[model samples]
Target: MATEHGVHAAHGSAAIANHAHPLDPLSAPEVERAAALCRQRHPSEQLRFVTIALEEPAKAAVAAFRAGGPIERRAAVVAIDRADGRVFEGRVDLAAGAVEAWTHRPGVQPYPILEEFADADRVIRADARWQAALRRRGVTDLDRVQIDPWPAGNFGDPAEEGRRILRGIAYARDADDANGYARPIEGVVAVVDLNAREVIRVVDEGAAPVPAADARYDAAAQPRLRDDLRPLEIAQPEGPSFVIEGHRVRWQRWRMRVSLHPREGLVLHEVAYEDRGRVRPIAHRMGLSEMVVPYGDPSPGQYFKNAFDSGELGLGRSTNALTRGCDCLGEIAYLDGVVAGGDGAARVLPNAICIHEEDFNILWKHTRAAGQTEVRRSRRLVVSSWATVGNYDYGFYWYFYEDASIECEVRLTGIIQPMAVGDGPIPPTAHRVARNVAGPIHQHFFCMRVDADVDGGGNTVYEVDTHPLPPGPDNPHHNAFAPALTPIRSEAESARTVNAATGRHWRIVNPSRLNAVGEPVAYALLPGETVAMMAGEEAAVARRATFARRQLWVTQHAPDELYPAGTYPSMSKGGDGLPAFTAANRPLEDRDIVLWYVIGVNHIVRPEDFPITSVHRAGFALKPWGFFDANPALDVAPPAAACDCPPGECVHGHDGHEGHAHGAAR
Candidate 1:
């Protein structure tokens, strides 16, 4: 890379050296003397130097001189040198003069002026012999005669070429920054004729000006370029399942079904049993003891016997449940095109089911319809026996058990999107904090609150607070475990305490608090319910229940039509039709949902979580399920077919040569 200054140096040195003669091998005095003499003799000329080899040294030299003003006469001569260093100088002989004279001819002149020709007649006459010579050699254009002249042996061309050369020189000179002119000289000349709407041509005298019509020419304008600007179109699948109606569903202990309607929309329906029922179904009669179990001691199959014969269990409402027990079984049968089949037959399978039990508190209530008590009780006991059947295979399982819920006893379990380590924490200094966290974080003197809604609709709610504890390994099951757990505090005590981690004092406040670790908790309150149980190791406690709820919904109620075949991995098949693999059933819409989540920086850092730190939250919304009819690209109509004739051929006829000749002339 040459620097700007380096370029300037190279150009300047070359130009000077090309115009000057070297004085001495190495002598200041000799160099100065030669420079002085050259300048004195040709004050307006810049001298250049070049070395030439000689056959022998000679004492003969010639001195050339011109007598004219600055605008016209210029001449040159050479002096010969001898081995003795003696110089012989005189007027150049005839041979030299002939060479010089030839160099001075019209075409050979270094600076020929076309306007100086008295008329075009003089030019035509002077070039007549040359033109004839060219014609004899089969050359036709009189404007293209070539000639060479002088010791320089430079070539010259006809008058038109000379004019074009001069025009190019003028353009270059005008464009040169050193000259500092505003626009090309030729362009300025054209501007003078702008009002006349005609092109101005420079011509020698005695030549008639070419008519504008004769000189007119046309140029094809390039086609206007266009950009393909279009919004991206997302293809949606067709079918009832692809619509919003496909997303609603219902669930029960061992069966799940969609509430279908002719037009209104789909609804959820589920069934469960209580211990007070009078009649029960035999496990063997229902064929409930054949299912496999995946894990856990005592096995779900062992409990099926007890649950089938004894009316000791109760049924409760659960937000999360799978419909595999009924819907899945139906779907398999439908695929096989069977209405019903014998027991143990491949087509006769139970609905896909996932079951789990939680302790209930005395505050809970259980009620059942009574008219057909025998049938209902029989169905419950019979189905309960199948809780362990097919349990080990991992499709779906049912549970029949009993227990009591303790106050503040929060059972955290639900369907949650798969997560990985080092994936959840919000980085500090994010531009937008509130929109990212699952919910807002609330800060106070001694505690921080985390609040997140299940979805934008607030159907489910999650909230938790920070407590102080010794730093240790985090619990793997629930993401709640942080190295340090902040100690829990009463509202009054929290207001008075200063956060040790952040070295900030806290003050009592209602909903809003300063130095809060997480955003203030907020969730949709179910109708008639005031508060939900909150418990877990700090972080785990807040998200576990919500995750569990989401799981239940996905397993039991998600619409089959919306998530038809090929949409997700299969979970079961062989004996009964069902996909064998379960997928993370999370749905995000056209735009991802944002969650604002915050947790304590450390167990002791209360004020640090203040102002709420944010982490991004995203979920997918259900979309239509199907394939596009055709490839989006290349489906466009082909451009109108083009004619085969060459451009201008049709309009100009077979003598298309005429159009080309005219175009070339321009």
Candidate 2:
């Protein structure tokens, strides 16, 4: 008798057909017997039979496993269809003992039997290797390890599986914490016991956290001082003391403030005052005084121009036009001396001069030019750098003043481009370079300022020099045939011929030349394929300036010396007592100084800057490297208990919020 999909009369006893048949039938007793026989064949095996419904096999299997139990000690035996090889495996100890079977075809046995067996000793052996790998790789925390099962057809030996587990653990452990700390936890090791076929232990071998003073560095040599700079008794304001507008000035830690009439800009007051008490200059370290000059009653043009030229205000008799020129003027107010204010009488003490004319101008000019409306509203820019500590000596470096000033300037320049709204498209060439006359052409301008304090026990710092770009089609001054492409031809062939007309033009063409907007068009530089063009000459110039400044700072300050050189570049602490380029430096301490910078493109005003100018600014602050050594999120661990939210409404609630009432409880 024949029945359903693949059932038919086999022998007279109705045996299930194998291979060619659409369905095969085996009784529940037959399946159980096959399982028992396989277990017997592999005597040291711990096994369980896993049955999955045919229609929704994979999901059902995973759901059962996720309902977790003590399966770590047993091997999973899965039952699957002969046609499609999907297996449902689970922890052996968790599976129910009863066996059941079913067949799609009538007249066939209700269950189909397929037996698979694995040595329990092999799994145990693999777990041991996995544990060893974790120890070798310095993995200590098991709770944080993530496990991903191998695919069905590509199963591996226990050792290999253990390695995969260790790899996953390493990846999960290496992620940066929210506070940017990136160090791996110490002395932690994860181990597996092969014979037991289980993960035996998660060990924590890391050292105890210590305060900065107890760290390896010499703390006694670096004396600690109070943050305040006020003195005890003051003989009424005397000598050539100048009055400043202190109202509305914001007070900052490690910095002092003095106000000047707006019209005075950045000019220094012609007054000299002396302190009247015994003081330790080193105790007032990191304190900087700022003289804020308001733009009092000046013509708008003067105000803007003065702000722009503020970098030219303070060059002592030096006449170097490019390196030492100062055509700007402004009022100066900065922390010059430390004072004690106890004993009912304030007396002046030895002071640390944080700001000086030259260094101030260098910072002022660079920032002013970069952030000016006329320049920033036109270009897109990105700037980033790393810091190191010991360039001069072990002494603290006060480079934050210069960095902060520059950052403030870039903030004023404001170059962020507004994103297009929904359904709006970005211009194809918005980030591309200009081609010929038909497409839009963009021109960029840049100005830089550099200054250093000569009075802070250091010689005149060298002004950073920059490299000029090679003259070519993109270089307006050198490319002889650049003017011919006033209006480009539409046909690609015509443009190519025109571009290659002159042998000299061909020589300089770069065939890879990008359009004005920086997008790559059909050009023949590398094979016949089109590619994006290189950044324009203006960008190259800015890049050179930034690079030169970084190199000069690192070389001059090498982090191992005492009294590290003070410059915008010297702000970060590094290994060997210098600033670091990578994230591996020691943590930043309370007295450490930091420098920050921001730079971007400037526009010289073209039709492209219509409506309002658009500017893109990018820069970062330099702190002592590795300032965050611990896991920043560890302090915020979640509660262990589950929340009490009622079914549907509280599915998203976290564990601790269960019993907490929201709104008015009924």
Candidate 3:
């Protein structure tokens, strides 16, 4: 980021385009060309570009594409005219250098541009009322204060209606690199109009003094360091066991194509696995559609803290530049992502995605009484990326295992959003972390969209749960339990929650494909740590992000229905995405379907989570259920010997007649 007007601006560089794959991201030249084309048609200096990225072709076109075939390249663009607050959408044909379509969107607000954040900071700091409020808290130095502009959520205030607004949160900093979050200036909120670039109101409710103590965790600020740790290293002598061509990856029996979306970040397409000599498709596309972080506090300074990270602030644009040994280990492959800044100039972020393989201890091991032992190692392919949105950091990891299972994990870590506390008893909704500093309770809910094609396209979803039978004719001993499978026949019955007491799971099966025992080939979704939305049903947070209210939702596959939250969630009223799509009550049995699974983490702030938080993980898994005849890893070879022991001694366990007893060490 570059410093401009005492605020950081987004980074980018101009370049040319020479794309090879049709699904590849839009190049720098394409972004510049698209913006220029829009500017020509609009002919206004007030137009600011919001989003500029590659417009993906239809699924049929991508499926029929060959290596050097005819391609029709296009770009999707969104811009807003700052003068009248009118939003525009356009499409550009790169090859012909022509505008394909241009339309105006009424009564909608797109995501905020990166420059507006800086502009908001500049405007708030210059306001006399904001300065007076700061002086009332005994803070006079303006340069040392940090002002963060947050999306001002709609609350039905007539004064703030039909206007773009941002709330300002301020903190006192000791130095340039010091932790500003350690000292929050609470009870002062600045409401600023983005288009007008002026402070609308400054509310000062309390006079809590800022904490003077500094909480710096850098090595230079520490007095001593640990000296008893040893370095551990991992190496792959023969290199990795996977092959990559462009965006396509092949490892072991798994195959898929990876792409970077401007909002969704990492997206997987055509995920399939090979059994024997046949390739079977599992999913057509999978990615994180939307995620929300809603705070529990309802004070004047904290009520409007619910933010749609992926929709309001683009996760793909917030990616971090990962380092080699620090972020990943062993033999690793990196992929760069191209994204545009506020100026619609594309730039390549180096090492935005990391790919590697990890040894997962053991796949399976057994020892027989006949003095024979066998063990095989387990390995998984990992594709991961990280994004830092304001005061929090997030990691998205996709793991593919040898036994034909897929796991998607979300790791959360970073500085917690802090609040200033007085010398009274602490509030129940927060925990005191440092001197006069409190950490607020919050929840992070993530929605994953899986376009499943269980053997082919047509599939059905069933809710499977275990029910114990009564001790009548069914169970004489009163210990008989069996699974009860119920088909979800319509969208009306698709929204459901997890019943962990019954070991419940949802399965997607192809009714046309039968397994060896006449069962449908299927994959089951195993829910991990999850919770329902804590907000009330009528609350604005719950209404805007309705996907989080339920753990599982099955809907008919539609290309335009991508985001779990609607296309524009910033300051949205409510009742958009999931609720609107499921209103049709379409048939879901034996039809092309999509699964929307929500993972929730209820974060109760701890004292140890103050200065910086350790990684906290939450996600779900998909396991093959009746899709395979037997164990898929049965053909995996045994691991090589770790020591120079004789071959027979390593595997042969001693029986009653001990002959060369095997040592405890492998």
Candidate 4:
């Protein structure tokens, strides 16, 4: 795979042409060279690299490069001084072989690396106090204990102040590969100082018996299996519909560039639709900027359980190596992702992103009164990736339809965060999944960043809501209604929520570009299945992730304003990302703006969600409103019959009915 992508690891031996695109993710060679340059700057000190990835070029520079100009490659490096626990942020100019900038950011801690996590596990298990706690619960098999390192969130605890801490959750496993979450060792929490590389404290309140249900979800655990299911195959004999060169993809009327980020797993750049022989821009950049998974239980061990997956753990670093038939299907193309490990070394995650085409049933259809029918099948190009963040797995899929509509779907399926409970009445904060296994209530909030470049950059956003007119002369029959378009003029005003009663949707229109009817060319953003953050404003998570409270937030474009929950959310205090960005309430009229849309999923644990949870989906869609003069898929040709078995010889009719023709006598 490295050979296929020309990603050599000789450290600066590979030319920059191997990563030519301005927005391309850092390759293996580039990551090595960048790390080497950082090491050269601090030759004597030991540095623990947290994140190393492409320092995306400015918007103007990327646009210029797309217009056949040159680009300077750079990498952003975040590391911590192991000796002093000081955080340092640096930028390396790979083109010039120099360290462009290095600054120490005080009052903050970078995300813990994999190496620290592994070391913490060793540090905890070896601790005499932790071993005593396990023995108190009648578990003496040290090898069977699983120490899961979690971010020690800032809760104003004096002992945790100014310390790089990891709160460990203990689980008992039957074997090496068995599901550890099923048997959570309650009333025990291990606090480890990562810099000290030792267990700082071990709290054992009261031990509860671990659940002993048959939680093994693999096929080997099942005694019986379904044998009646038949095989179904997806074949695109001619090949995939999309063409890819470098990291850019072109499918039907869609054109976009794809990149994998250490923080944002899948990023789509310069997303545009080709219309009337001209490629027009829709969004300059699109990605999941931040996500917060906050458990609702207020228990001592569960209250501080909120996790900022992207900012704290990094989605790209946790991305799974997708399988062919399982993760994707039908003439698939895979992209390898390169991310920095704890030592600043390049770690290539093969098949991190999957690209394929899906049959969406139908695009458009019409049946005439004369018994003639015309229909066109719908096919969409899907760009997706999955990440296993601790107990849960998340799949991010971006779909590009031939009709010029875009959709982003997130699928959640994995082991629920389990807790051990006694045979008393279950707590309101949790549901009993097994005999003594309880799953806590939690919410997953995802913030999507869309840098709107709707026809061009000079765009305005309007909240369109359907309102029925008052019963009067204007509505004689009391049935007249119209869409009330409200312009989001200022940053403060742009912070809005979804009003399902009004059928609310936001429209991004380029005021400078007019459609055929002399209206602004626009696209509408339709949200889906959103639930508000149940945490109050005083809650640490609500203050830190203010963007989750509202479904939509519009801010004037700023190069540094990328993440919704600020740069470092590992142990952040609060009020940094959207709240800080929109504090000034800048005017957004006819300006280059970005929309931060939050998609929330409220998970109330169900009995069926146990063993292994099925996929729960939530997403949003972007449809061309006034951007297209008419139906963009009108020119799509109808699908041809697969087999040439003459009319009566085939088992199915042209309309896919068994042993029958359309409009035939029964």
Candidate 5:
């Protein structure tokens, strides 16, 4: 991030068509040049590719004084030598226009995890082995069948042996609803080793048959509408409330740069909100670090289905090109993302990033003792991206508010994963999402990495709790309460939980930088849509993602400790990421720190989830505490009342906050 006007600007090199800043992605030409180098190295031997992404360069100290470390130009390319199945990592310098460094990641297949899904899907369509399993069910119209390969993760299995494998299921689809898995052709499973490019195991119970898709319970189809029930269109002039300048977006006083990452979906960096005439730093960088979706029911077919969404498979790599009016509204700006294809070529996911402003209904309001009123309608700058992982679709959105707070949210929608529970009552372990389609109960865990450079990098964790004061001489009534603010002095003490009952919250404060009242400039961790991972430490699912164990883990800053769940968790055994990082119990107080905040959903499927379900959001906000002198947005006056009601009449009503406990972690 380049510093201008005492504010750190959003980082990005604007080399593409309509991009604003350089969240630092490799240009198509740069990636192509790197791929040519890999091909030149492989020459005659067949090579399988993994990832070719921007290897961030180290930043200089003067500019990166707050967020410290590398922010230079470099690219990383990973590929597998198929002749011996060896994976190689290549680093290229954009300035030199050539490969500057190379290394071999021994025993690990570069593109083993995700590419297998596509390979498995292709084999089922082209090969005869999976075709035979389909023939047994009397389905000859193979064109109508959709073979979707799911991530069959290795659960400490010794048999994996560094090979790319995928488990596939077939679904009968007549049209593309983005919910192809809704119409499940049950009682069939295909185990494919992508390295071998063959279906190794075919599970056909024969007891259960493929459910009929007679269009009666089509999940994607909308109900027939007559010449009635037409709604009025809502429009806002002034084009949009936000403006995109390079990779950066400026909405009111909130300014943040958006990055298109290969692993992390939508990364927001150089985040700072303007308060009055001065600018203050909120978060230097933030995004989803790692995620795990662990299924509850563990049978022969379901046990191996836990997905390390970010680690095993790349979320940004699978991002879908968003529709204009459907995905975003008003005047919009789109940023295309480039990812390494299966052949190590730079593939474009068009309209991969969407930047726009959303009307959140209200910002803030107040009433006077006299017949007077004041209110402000809220609008937010939204940076979003969508990714489809097998049966589920996740839309990652980062909302920047005028109040100087940033909300990181994940919207979960898409077809539910249908099971072979033919014509029976809803199973105890699962809930029926569609007709005869039992969607297994599961949990989606997401850890957001927030680098809060409150005033600078020297930050401390402060836990504030409301405690009942002892009924002594001072407290005549037993109802007296005292709020205690405890600054966590160690890393081990920072592994805390979100206590919903009490007014419990955590704050990342730069103790050295104090506000006018002599308090540290800080941002409060206001809990958002919340759910903890249910899998215990003993479970294989826990072994896959140790970060999901706690809701919050604060670790002293180390450049190498980037991922919470270790990198290469596809066929990994265990003990690499968060648990291993925290085991040393490193010093944490008043140091540069990274806060891993976990938020999720215990997705107990309901019938409403069918037919391309509604968005289930889980997130939290980094609210300004003493970072602002007052309500930073207070200076900006609200828009005039547009309704017919009298001023201060209906205005007394809440600004849409009823049961919404702004402080509740739940």
Candidate 6:
């Protein structure tokens, strides 16, 4: 697979390209070289690399490229100690082939699985303390324990120190079966502190009450199972309707370059559509900024289930190596992703990104004179990727429509986190997503950071609100209404909740720019069905994901302020990331701004979601509010229906010589 993508690492040599494109992720060669340099500087202690990803080029530097300036890409590398939970940083100058900076940091928690697994083995390997805890839970076999690692937050306790922790679960894994979720060790949670690299304590939060049959998550144990159904195929006579030049895609009127990041997964760059004569700009850059899945169960061990998937763990790096024909239908274009592992070796993730064109219902249809209907079928360009974070597999997609509207969607599937269901009735706070397993009712929160450079850099977030008018002279009829748009003038006023029933939408527009009707040219964000976190205001999850509290949050653009939840939010206390970034209440109007839109499902687990849940999606649209001159697809030709003119006699009064030019005989 590495050879296929020209990224094959042979022995001690790196096969990654060292060239730095604006949107390109960190290369293996850059990482390998950077890690070697960092280790040389810190010769005393052993360092294990954790995250080796690109420190994205700033927007200002990116903007300079429009004038044909050189863009330099840098790599941000982080590593942890093999013995103690100490964090270190290494920054590499990719172009100059040098390590730009190195720093030894404290208080930053570690997340590399290798470090935790090593530390956990030291403590829980036939240790008398953990073995006693396991015996109380009725598990006799001490050999089948699977130690799962998680970040240990400081929780703002003045007495507590920062480090990593391991949650020990029972392993029911077999060579042929893939139901690790169903094999949780009931009634015992081993709390090993990696900071101390020893067993500090054990928390005996007994498992959920249910029968033993609930643990059967194997395919053969599935209820209501039936034989495999008939085969279906998606055949394209003309092959795929799109062209993939490297990772750049061109489908219908859409044009964009796609890449996968270690945290953002599928990222679309220089996204635009062909409209009228010229190519117009849509978004300079966009992707899933961050996501948080917080469980609602309030037990001691459960309340801390506010998992920040992207920040805490590299969700983008966890993308599944997508399978062809099964993951998508029709002609698909596969793109490989490259990432550096803890060993500092670049690993090639093949088919991590998928691109295809899909027939999307109706674009526009009209019954013309003589019942001559002009109907155009819409075909959209879809760029998709999926990531599995522990018990959940998340799918992210970017769809570009012919009418220049962009849709960003997320699909949640995969097994729900299981608890040991003992012999008793399940609790009321959780729903049974499976036969006997209970799924704690939780909210899946997603925040997308949109750098909507609508008609260039200077833009304002104009909020349109529809309100009921009073019974005065202004409203002669009782059904009269009034609509107004208030420009978000300051950061303090930028945070807004979803007013779904009121037809509310935030328009990103440049006040100096106007359309044909003298209206401010803009693009509006239509946030679909979503649920914010229900945790208390003072909760750690709520504080970290402050951007999730509202539907639309706009702040002055700062390249460093990328994630809504602050950078390195794994074990952070409250008052960081967006909350701290926006506390200045910076003026928002007529300035470069970044908008964060939170969208997700209000998941109350249904019985059918067990074993593996089907895909349930939530989405939002970036539509041309006043950004376009007119309907971008208006000039698109209608689909060829049964034409009355018939034969080769020019379908809609065009000369049949389109395929040929009839000049002189020459």
* Model with the higher TM-score, candidate 3 or 6: 3
TM-score of every model versus the real structure: 0.15, 0.18, 0.93, 0.94, 0.88, 0.89
Preferred candidate (lDDT higher): 1 or 5: 5
lDDT to native, each model: 0.18, 0.21, 0.83, 0.86, 0.72, 0.71
Stretches of candidate 1 above 4 Å error? 1-666
Score candidate 1 by lDDT.
0.18
Give the alpha carbon lDDT tens digit for every residue of 363-393 in model 4. 9877663334566879999999999999999
Q: For residues 1-666, what per-residue lDDT tens digits would candidate 3 score against the true structure?
A: 211212111122221122255676676677889989988888887888888878887766776675445676898988888888789889999899998898899877788887888888998899898888888887877789999777777788887887888889899887988887888898888998888878898878865768888798788888998899899888776677876555667899998877667788888888999999888999988989999998887777777888889988888888888898999997777666777776767767777877789999988888774446676779999989999988899999999999999999999999898888887986687788888888878899999999998888699999999999878987899999999999999999999999988999999999999888889999999999999888878788988999999999999988778888898888888778899999999999999999999999998888889798999999999999989999899987665434334556566223343333333333
Best candidate, lDDT: 4
Model 2 over residues 216-297: C-alpha lDDT tens digits? 1124424684568875331212211122121111111112222111111111211111112211011101111111111111
Candidate 5 is scored at a TM of 0.88
Consecutive 10-residue window with the lowest summed lDDT within model 5: 1-10
Model 5 spans with C-alpha error above 4 angstroms: 1-23, 41-45, 59-71, 109-118, 125-132, 137-140, 173-179, 205-207, 214-223, 226-236, 424-426, 640-666
- Whichever of 1 and 2 has more TM-score, that candidate is 2
Sort by lDDT, best first: 4, 3, 5, 6, 2, 1
Task: List the pairs of residues colliding in candidate 4.
Answer: none
Q: Give the winner by TM-score.
A: 4
Task: Give candidate 2's TM-score.
Answer: 0.18
- How far in Å is the alpha carbon of 131 misplaced in model 6? 2.8
Error of 4 at 522 (Å): 0.6
